[model samples]
Target: MNTSSDDASSTSESVSDNDSDNVPVIKKSKASTSAGLLSEHNKDNNEEESINSMHRNHPPSVTLEDMITDICFHPKLDTIGIASITGDVFMYKYNNEETNLVSTMELHLKACRDIEFSEDGQKLFSTGKDLCIAITDVETEKLVRLYEKVHEQPIYTMTIINEHVFVTGDDDGVVKLWDLRQKGSEPIFSIKEVEDYISAMITNTDAKYLACTSGDCLTTINIPERKLHLQSEDHGDELTCLGLFKMESKLLTASNKGKMYVYNWGEFGLHSDEFPNATKKAINCMIPVTENVVITGGEDGIIRAISLFPYRHLGIVGQHNFSVETLDINNDGTLIASSSHDNDINFWNVQYFESLNVTEPQKGGKRKWLEHNLPSSKIHNRSDFFAEL
Candidate 1:
C-alpha cells in the first residue's frame, strides 16, 4: 500500500448511479429558491406534483443559476448548505426522494468560496471573495453576525472546528481561528505558514490539530498550543483536499497529479503510503462514505469509489459533464451530492451501501476485507510526540 502501484482498485466496476433513474420528488421553493436550484414541484400549494415522465429521464438536482463553489451537509439534519460563486447561500432539505428549500440569503457581495454548518445545525457560516464572513441563523433565516475584512485576501476555504470554534483560510495563506463566544471579532490565533492559498483543511477528531493542504505540502497546526506542529515534505504537486478515515488513524490528501497520499495519524511530516488513482487524473474533491470507502471526484468528471488499507478501486459511483467542484455526504451517509463547474448539483443514491447483507461483508461487499473498525481511539501509536519539547 505504500507504493504508487494500482491494484484491485483499478477495476472498472460502477456502482449504481442516479443519472438515468426516475423517482418522484416534491419541491417547494419557500423564498428566493427559484434561481440556482430545481426539483419536481406542485403547481398548486400543498399539492404533490406528479410527473413520473420527466422524473424518469432526469436526475434529482438543485439547479443553480450561478456556478456553485462549495457545499456541505448539516451536522444533524437532512439539510445542506450550498455556496454560490455569486456569494449567495442556499439552504435546502433533501431526503430519499424529495427536496424542499429551507431558505436562501445573499450573504456576500462577491463569490462565496466555502460554507459550513455549525455543529448543532442552528447556524451557517459563509466566507467568500469579499473578504467577509457571514453567520446566519438557520431557523430564522436572518443574518446574525457579519465581519468585514476577515482576511487581507479573499477567504477561500473554511471548516468548523466545533460548536463554538471555526477556522477560515484566505487566498494569501492566512489561517485564522475564531471563537463565537468571544465578543470581539479578532481571531484567537492567526497563522500564515504557507506561501500560497489554502486549498483544503481537516482537523482531527478531537479538534486538537488541523492538517492543511496548500501549495505542494501538508501542514499541521496545534490548536491548543497555537503553534505550527510541522510541515510534511513537499509532494511535488498542488494538494487539493484532505480526509481522515480509519477512525481518524490515517489522513488522506488528494493531489493535482491524480494521487492519494496517505499519512500516519499525528505524523504529518511525510506520507506513509501512496495510491495512484485508477484514472490517474486530478482528484478535485472527495468524501469518506464509509470507514474504508471514499467517493472521489476526478478531473475527467467521474465519481469513483476507492478503498484503502489494502487499497482497491471499488468502482464509479456517478459522473458529471464538467469537473466536479465539490462532494458531500448527507448526515446519515444515505446520499452523496456532487457539484461540478456547472449550475447543477447531482445527488447519488449511496444509501444502498448502508444495508449491505453482511455475510462477512467487505466494503460494498465485492471482496474479502480486514477489520477496519480499529479499537484504539488514540490518534497514533506513538507515545513520545512531545518529549523533545
Candidate 2:
C-alpha cells in the first residue's frame, strides 16, 4: 500500500477532477508474504487482464467532514450513516447516480461510535462515548428507546444480525449479546473479561456463527449454543477490525500493528491457510466486497483491496488526511463509504475481478512484541485531530 502522506485538501483536490479521463492508472502491487502460510497463485489471462483494467480505472472520491468514529450503509437504501467523535450521527443520501451525498442528518451528544440499521432499514441503533445505545425511528429522526448504562466503558462497535438479535463491544473487553424485545438495558448473553478490548464484531450471512476480534485473537461463537467454537491466534498485533464474507466459513481480520489474516472454516477446525501481509500502519476497519474481496482502512490513511481465497494484492486508494476509523460496504457491493480521524467521509466506486497473485515470505526476521493499548478519552477527543463536519 502507498505510505506517502498528503493533506485531505490535496486529496480532495485530486478527487475534484473526477470528470478528467487522463488520471494516471494504478497497478496491482506485487504482494509479499510474511509467514509460511501464504502461497502464490497464477493469474489466468482473462483474470489478469481484468485486474489490470481495474487498476487503471481509479474511482473518484467524495468528502464529508467530521471525525467519523463509525459508519454503516442501509441494507437496501442508497444511503450511508456515520457516527462522529463529537457525539453526533449523520445520514447521507447518495445522488441519483449513487455517487455523491444528496442530504444529511445529525443524530446524537458525545462522539457516536457505532450505528446499525434494522433489517428493514426503518429503525436505527447507535452507541457511543456517552455509554448509551439508542434506537431511533429513521424517518422521523426521533429517539424511540435508550439502553443506558449498557456498558461501563465507551461502546466501540455493534452488529445487528437480525431484527431481534444484536451484539455490542466496549473498551471494557466485554461483548454483550442483546435481544431487542427485552426493552431493558440487560443483555441476554455476555462474554466478560476478554483478553483485550473488543474492537470489531461480525456474524455470518446464515447467522450460525458470530465472531469477535480483540487484540490479536479471534473468537468464534456458535450462535445456537452460545458456545466458543474457535479462538485463533492469527494477527501479529491487536486485531482492530473484522469482516465476514458470504458466510461463517470465511473471514478476514486487520490488526493494529499493520497485519491482515484470512481464515477458512473446515470440518476438522478453523484453518489458517493464508495471511501475514502487512499494511503501512494500523488497520482499523475492514469491509468485505465479495466472498474473496475486501476493503481495508488504516491509520496511514490508505484504503486497500485484498483478495482472500487465492490471496493477492488488488490495489490501494489514499485520500484521507488522518487515520481511517471506520468503513462500510453497500449491500450491492457497488460502493464503499469510509471515515477518518481527520473528520472526513469518502465514497468510492467498486471493482470486481478474479485471480490475483503474491510472493511467499523471505526468511530472517526479528522477533517482535505484539500488544494494543486502547487510547484514552483525551486522545479520541482531541480537537486538533477531529475536524468539524
For each candidate, the alpha-carbon lDDT, in order, equals 0.72, 0.62
- The CA lDDT at 146 in model 1 is 88
| Candidate 2 C-alpha lDDT tens digits along 44-127 | 344445643443342334454544566788888877776655666666677423345544545556667778889899999988
Which ten-residue region of model 1 has the weakest summed lDDT? Answer: 1-10
Clashing pairs in 2: 66-343, 67-343, 85-111, 87-110, 87-111, 215-238, 215-239
**Candidate 1 residue-wise lDDT, 182-259, digit = tens:** 887899999999999888889877888898888999989999999999999988888988888889898998987888
State the weakest 10-residue window (summed lDDT) of model 2. 369-378
Candidate 1 lDDT for residue 36: 29
Instruction: Say which candidate scores most in lDDT.
Output: 1
Query: In candidate 2, residue 385 scores what lDDT?
Result: 27
Tell me each candidate's TM-score.
0.77, 0.72
> Residue 136 lDDT in model 1?
90
